[model samples]
Target: MKHTGFRIAVIGAGAIGQTFAESLLQGSIGEIAFMDLREKPDFLSDERYGRLTSIHELVAWRPNVVVECAGHNAVTTIVPSVLREGFDVVLSSVGALANPKIRTALCSSAVAGGSQLVPIAGAVGGIDALSAAARSGLTEVMYTGRKPPRAWSGTAAAQEVNLDTLTSQKVIFAGTAQEAALKYPANANVAAAIAIHGLGFEKTRVTLIADPAIRLNCHEIYAKSRSGELRVNMSNEPSPGNPRTSWLAALSLQQTVLNKVLGAQWAA
Candidate 1:
C-alpha cells in the first residue's frame, strides 16, 4: 500500500519524541505533526509539519497514526483519547501498560474505535521468540536491568545504595514486573515488554542493578515455557539527549512507524 499522504502526530517533544519527529520527517513518511504541552512548539513552521497544544486538537486534526514517545503519564492522559478517536497508535511507553486501569481503558478505547495499539520493542531483542514460546504456556519469565550508578541517581536505587560511593555491582531491586515498573518508571519499559509479551506482570520476575563499571545500559531476559527456553542479553547506548532512555528505543519507534506506513508485519 502506498502511504503517499499519510499524516502522523507525535506526542511529546523531549528526547525520544523529538527524535521520532525528525526521523519520520527524514524518512518522508508523511506530514509529521506533534502534540505537546510545551509553552512554545518546535518545528511548527517548517511547512513540512505542524504542532498542536492538546489531545483535543490532535483528534480534531485527524491524524492517520499517532506515535507516542512521551512518558507513562502520556499513556494515561493522552493515548486513550487518541485511540478513542479511531486512530491507530504506536505506544513507546510499554511500562505504562503495566497499570491495569490504563491498559484496560486503552484497549477498550481501541476496540470501540476500531484502532490498533502497537507496542514498540525497545532496548531488547528476541521478543518474537519469547512471545511465541508463551503460546504454549510460559513457566517463568525474568528480566534484569543494569545501568551505571550515576544513572540510578534520583531513583529508589539512590536510597537503597549510595549512587556516588558504590564500588561494584549492587542488586537494587527484585520483585515482579509490576513492582519494577511502579518503582522505576523511568527504566521499566524493557521489563514491562518482557512481561507483557511472555507473561502477565504479576508472574514475570524483575531484577535491577546499579553498576559503577558500565556506561551503557543492559537488559537480560530468561524465559522457560512448555515449547522451549529463551535467553536474550543486550547492552544499549543511551540517547545523547536523554540518558534515561536508550538510543535503541528511538530506533524501535522508527521501525514501528515504518511497519505501519509500509503495511509490513513486525514480530514484536
Candidate 2:
C-alpha cells in the first residue's frame, strides 16, 4: 500500500484534469504535479503534490507517468516529448490519435523512448470485448452519440441543424469515425475509442444525435465480429463545471491512472 515513489503529472488544470487530480489525491499515489498554460501554485498542493507552470519545469519534475486531460493542442505539443522522455502517458484526447501525422509521431516516440501510450475508455464501454473481438475479425462497429441540443453548439452541427428550435431528436451527422472526429472534435472521443478498439477510423460507423429530450450524454455502441455480437449503452452525467464533458469520462481517467500505477491487482 506504500505508493510513496509513484510520481504522476497531470497536463491541464481544466475540469477533467482537476477531477482526475482530486481523485488521485484521495488515493495512495505519491507526488502529483500539474502543468498548464496558466499556473495555480496553490492548486492541489499537499504533502505529496504540487503544481508547475512551464513544460520545462514539468520535465524537471521527472514524472513516472503523465496524464493528458488537455485538448488536441496538448496532444500534439506536450505528449510526444513526454513519451520521448520514457514516461508512460494516459491520454484523454483519444480523438487526436485519429490524425495520421500525430499518430505516427506518438507511436514513433513511444517506441524510441520505450514508453507506453495508454488511452482511456472515456464515456463508453465494452472496449475489452471489442478489443477481443477485433482479434477474431470484427465485421462492423457502430457508435451513436446523443446529447442535449445545446451541447451541439459551436460544432458543425450548428450549421446543419437549428439547435435553437429543435424540439426532438435529430441526426446531425452520419459518417465514418474519421469524418465525425474531423467535424466534431468536442464529441469525438467516444467514437475514436470505439474505432481504435474495434476497427480503424475509416471502417467504423459513427452517428451524432442532438436530442432535446435527453439531459445527460448518451453513447450507444453496436459491434459485430467473428466471435459474437455486442451492444453497450451508457448515459453519463455532465461534469459539474464543464457540461461539454461527462463526469464518467473524468472517472474513467482516474481509474486508468490507478490501474496503471497500482498494477493488475487494482480494479475499478
Scored against the true structure, residue 10 in model 1 reaches a CA lDDT of: 89
The TM-scores of all predictions, comma-separated, are 0.92, 0.92
The CA lDDT at 255 in model 1 is 90
Off by over 4 Å in 1: 1-3, 41-48, 264-268
Alpha-carbon lDDT, every model: 0.86, 0.86
Candidate 2, overall lDDT?
0.86
Model 1 weakest 10-residue run by lDDT: 259-268
Candidate 1's error at 6, in angstroms? 1.4
lDDT of 1 by residue, 125-153 (tens): 99999989999999999999999887777
